[model samples]
Target chain A: MAYKCYKLESILTINNLTKKFGYLTAVKDLSFTIKKGNVYGILGPNGSGKSTTLGVVLNVVNKTSGDFHWFDGKISTHDALKKVGAIIERPNFYPYMSGYQNLKLVCKIKGVNYSKIEEKLKIVGLLERKDSKFKTFSLGMKQRLAIASALLNDPEILILDEPTNGLDPQGIHQIREIIKQIAAKGTTILLASHLLDEVEKVCTHVVVLRKGKKLYSGRVDEMISSNGFFELKCNNQEALVTLLERHNSFSKIKVENDLVTAFLTEPMRSDDFNKYLFEKGIILTHLIQRKESLEEQFLQLTDNQTNQI
Target chain B: MLRLLNIEYYKLKYNKASRVLIIIYFALLSLMSLFATIKFNIGPIKFHLAELGIFNFPYIWHFNTFVASLLKFFLLLVIVSMVANEYSNKTIKQNLIDGLSKKEFILSKFYCVIALSLISTFFVFVVSLILGFIYSSYTELTIVFSDLEFLIAFFVKLLGFFSFGLFLGMLIKRSAFAVAAMVVLFLIEIISYGIVCGINKGTELADRIYQFLPFKSLWNLIDEPGSRLSAVKEVAAQIGEDLSYDYSVRWYEIAIVLAWTALFIFLSYRLLKKRDL
Candidate 1:
């Protein structure tokens, strides 16, 4: 038999989704899209609507207004959601049930075969504790079991909200490694987290949010690779600022604590800028070139947003 | 329907509280058979409780069902907590994310209620048969099978009560508060009966109105079999009391309780549908 195979680029799309808690808007007109094979990160601080957005899409939290759909502009039906595994906030299960029992229930709901339960449990490293009750498992084991349950059907897109919120360093590392392996198998992932470094290590695209608003959304590299300001100290900081202020390459220049930090307007290598400064007769005792860190960019975005409010 | 019930089965099977309550409920149901062995004497009133024709054909059905229906409270705890745990553990939200729709979740609980009712009804049927064979003098098949509506009424009563518990669990979202709310509602019915009968100085109007109350209507399904016993008749005769109450199952009362069962399940579904988990 011959059949047609449809290729959908956008695995999940949200258009102006908004959720309100009476007087408080948990998520406000938020919109983003997750394409196939993209490890998307929803980067935000606490109470910034990261979980709320994921909740609305997963249909756990009802949206006050707006729309979201999965798989090629179609409305999110059970079939579409069955192929999208998700865990919102913390891992929730029947506390009295074992890890295997919890996954068995999940498999029943997702209509997956029971044989996959052990395989998924092994993936999360819960095979050793499969018979232990959920209440008996530590928080880390509970999270790993949740991830196993989510992967029972081999979902096309995995949505995780604060998956590593409360774990020790090793536990966090283990969770990240599991996520990395899942993504390596070519499954699209949408991860929401308040940890900047976690997103830096796992995500390919990012949407930065603050106070229920989107501050930035683009490739992680683009957000980090923007025209970054530099920090340099020389004997004559005043001369460096004055000489560089007239040049077409530098847009913004500031002098603080006997140091000069300049933002480049046009694309120019650090070596070229240092050459220009050297030719201007300003010798440098300290020459430091720094690219914008995700932390700095995230802080600047949220800070600017707070000041605007 | 099988899929939904299968899902509910795993959840209830693995829950420790549910397992304990289920065992206790069935144990209590089975313990009712020991009532046939009671033979004692109260001063000047020598009596073997089983010899009073209480276990006689037809009456055995009424007596057994009425007694067993009182034990439905145990399974009601199971149903209510089953819904309550979903909220407390937030598994309902996870279930939805795992692709179980809201409607399917409600159906799962409803199916559980139905299954519990059927199983308890079957258990009561079997226990009554054993008790009847041991104590009943009338051994005819027709007599034994005559008044089986009481069994059907028992099943309906359980279904209504457990559905009400499920609805309350969904509405209250806490096990203790949901059970407390059920008590409060029952108390409201009792107080209303008191006020209505007190104002009119008679039970004539109150009796007519009490038939509409859902909780009282469940009791109306199987009129108390205690008053029909010969021992009670002799005692009431000595006190010059009138023993003229209806002691048979009424169809309208069963209809009323069945209607309430559908309403409670629907309300439970609506509660889950509107709430943001």
Candidate 2:
């Protein structure tokens, strides 16, 4: 797919922000910028201040120190917020009210005229159940309604926390489609979730945190090396292990039962080794290059709990 | 402000607790009215303690009576239920995060409470007017035109109770606490009145406290021969002839109620705005 780059202007900027809850610091001096039209993902473990950071940025929770600016051609938050919509926590709707009525409430608060409620319902694909009481919605449908409510203002930005909390695979696919649809319309998205796989798919850039501090923040593909690694499968694993042990050309060597893995110092080095093994009458079943996954990058950056804030 | 009011109005119209309260209120009022009609044989009797039940209902059968006697208690229930529902359901924290300003959200609640109270009071007044006509066999008994003096007194009493209920909800955002405080307020006043009359021979400090308490002041709005001031006088005379209980509604009490409401709202708003959602 051909990529269309946004102008790359900063839409959200945070500097030296902190939030303290009595004895514990919820967010510890975090700083980062989210550029316009970028799908920025915030990744963190449980209680790692992901929610706290969002709460402070959205002005729902007061920060103990530091400042943030929404530089999308607006001065104050009310103006900026007029162009922004958010769902900071779980889906909230009056249980007695129908899904449409709940969205109407959000519309009133957001001060946006939404004559076509069905359009939003269509966007989330909940049009058939718009009349259902909010309490009757499954967690996934409730989340869709929450997203629909945030979309009411036709906002330029959407801030969501754990947007797909409880969902089956199909529901997750549905939500992913809806998010991509919104993004296709040029709405910048700021999403927080512990699901690295989801972030890897939807986000352009990501920020990872551990114990209230920023561990890593950059372009997603760059964060995970796009370069390849060798994946070798062999019949004579003992002979291959002996050969690898004699040569110190790699790091992170591991032998698990019948399989052994060793990182290569150069690409195609595995091909030369395979040829030598073949000459020795050792059959190689599988030999392919493997790219790093987001999970691996996450574990690498946040290696230990002690290193966390 | 108007937008906030609209939101509150919409929520109340759709809230289940509000709906249940309305249904229960009319059910109780009809049973009381039916019992009174059968006992008096007047179809719409003017004044019968048997029909009157607990709260004061003088020579009237308007909406105010239905509201004063039935809906007032139900209104308190609404406030308690509304706050409690938020906590029990874990929605208050969610609403705050959804972009409602702290002041706007709290004000929406108070707005709903006041609107419901006024609506209930008006509904009672209207029902009484209708009953007045039905009993007299005259279709044209105009709605009673209350004078400024009566209306002011009624407003003061109504606002005092309304504010008290609001304070209770704020202090105990949890449903159980809110409901308990409301029940206690009502029970303490009812029990104190009985104790002063029967046990203490009307000479105890409890009698004096009962006379000045906010809940008891609600009776002052009724057009009775024994003014609440007189009730205060009865208690004050117990100590000395020169002093009376000061039964008349005082501005200071209104100030105190307003202050209490403000304090509760401020504290709750602070917690809402500062705490993690």
- Measured against the true two-chain complex, the DockQ scores of the candidates, in the order shown, are 0.83, 0.32
Best by TM-score: 1
Q: Candidate 2 on B1-277: residue-level lDDT in tens?
A: 6887897777677987788887787666444444335444466645443333222222343223423543466666777677667666666655554556667777887777667656655555555544544453333323234322333444445555665666666666675677777778789778768867787666466645654566654554434422233344576678776552343335545555455555556666665565555
Estimate, for each residue in A1-309, the C-alpha lDDT of model 1 and write its tens digit: 123224438888899988899999888888888788779999899999988888777877788999999887654466677888888878999988888888889988889999999899889998889998889998998889889988989999998989998999989999999999998998999999989888898889999988888888999998876577778889887788888889887778887788888887667777887887888898888777666779888997899889988
Which whole-number lDDT from 0 to 100 does residue A284 have in model 2? 81
lDDT value for candidate 1?
Answer: 0.88
DockQ, candidate 1, vs. native dimer: 0.83
Candidate 2 residue runs with Cα over 4 Å from true position: A1-7, A72-82, A226-228, A233-249, A265-285, A304-309, B23-71, B121-147, B185-249
Q: What level of docking quality does candidate 2 show?
A: acceptable
Q: Per-residue error at A135 for model 2, in Å?
A: 2.4
For residues A113-187, write the lDDT of model 2, one tens digit per residue: 768577898989899999999999998899899888888888777998988777888888888899988888878
